[model samples]
Target: MTKQELKEYYWIRRNITKSEQRLIELETAATKITAQLKNKHDAIMGQGNTSDKVGNTVADMELVRDEMTEQIKRSYAVLAKLEKAIEELPAREGYLIRSRYIELLSWEQIAVDMNYSWKQIHRIHAEALHQLQ
Candidate 1:
């Protein structure tokens, strides 16, 4: 993989996390909307039509939910591919890549965890990227 492709692992992971969070938020909103709609229906039962508003809201939410779900699926596919590639590397290389991208660890933290000097960690990271290619 090129550097850009390798770098995308971090983005894909981030997107997955954000998408999942958004899904939770959407679910909460949907529940609240449902409750509100029920109350509105009871209040305005024969006075006016609520179907249009309810239909529009439900359609919009479903569109957003479907889009987010697809994004999450695609992100997971990329993440799985990246993870498999990382797993194929040597132990140290795999660790470096996983730590930096998947675990979102800082270089210093990775160096400390790996018991290597900062400069040495960079060197290892370079080698890991090369192996990834």
Candidate 2:
């Protein structure tokens, strides 16, 4: 790979990892929000003072939702960087490497999509990675 291509690949890899982490964080926050909402719903379902206590739960849920939204926005930023890097990749290797490695497609899947045998795909992928060094 040319120095520019290598730099692109490095940034793409970093962006992909960052996006994945952001997604994970979003998932975690969403889970917590869901649980909190569910508990709040259950509390409201119960008779008496339980319904009054829901204000705090609702506040917490909103905070979690806001956090998840921010994470999703940051994730989109990372995705934009990754997309630009992918566009800069060499014609011979960029698309395949970005789709397979950055997007996390399986070798067999990439082969089928690319109209190559799995073995050939593996070889080409190996060569692509080697060129980045």
Candidate 3:
């Protein structure tokens, strides 16, 4: 792969991590909303006007949850493709790609982990991209 292609892959991988985080946040929100709706459903008696408002709120939250679920599915699919592409690379290069992108590690952190200078890691990354093509 060209350097630019490899850079694109790296960005896509990074996006997967970000999307995964967003998925978690969305799911959490959905769960909270579900709980609130459940509580409101159970208390169906005194608060008549409040119940109508809660009904509308629950419907809106359900729509948001459905949208988030679809987004999470798409993110997973993209991440899978990027992962499969990196799987063909040599061990060191693949590790570097995963660390920097999928794992979302900083260059300094990756260098520390691999016991190499950050500059050397970048050099290796550039070389690795050639093999990817």
In lDDT terms, which candidate is top? 1
Off by over 4 Å in 1: 39-45
Q: How do the candidates rank by TM-score, highest first?
A: 1, 3, 2
1-133 per-residue lDDT for model 1 (tens digits): 6667777888777788888999999878888887777777866566566756775787799899999999899888877888789989999989998898778899999999999999999999999988887
Better of 1 and 2 by lDDT: 1
TM-score of each: 0.79, 0.46, 0.56
lDDT of 1 at 35: 78
Best by TM-score: 1
Worst 10 residues of 3 by lDDT: 1-10
User: Listing every candidate in turn, what is its Cα RMSD in Å to the true structure after a full C-alpha superposition?
Assistant: 2.4, 8.3, 4.8
Worst 10 residues of 1 by lDDT: 42-51
Where is model 2 more than 4 Å wrong at Cα?
1-52, 108-133
Give the TM-score (vs. native) of candidate 1: 0.79
lDDT digits (tens) for residues 1-133 of candidate 3? 4545444655665676776677677667767867777777757647677777766776776677677677767766765766787898888889998787657689999999988998999988887777767
Please give the range of 10 consecutive residues that has the lowest summed lDDT in model 2.
Answer: 1-10
Report every candidate's CA lDDT: 0.84, 0.65, 0.74
Per residue, candidate 2 scores C-alpha lDDT tens digits across 56-117 of 55566567656756765665666576556556657656767876755667777888888899
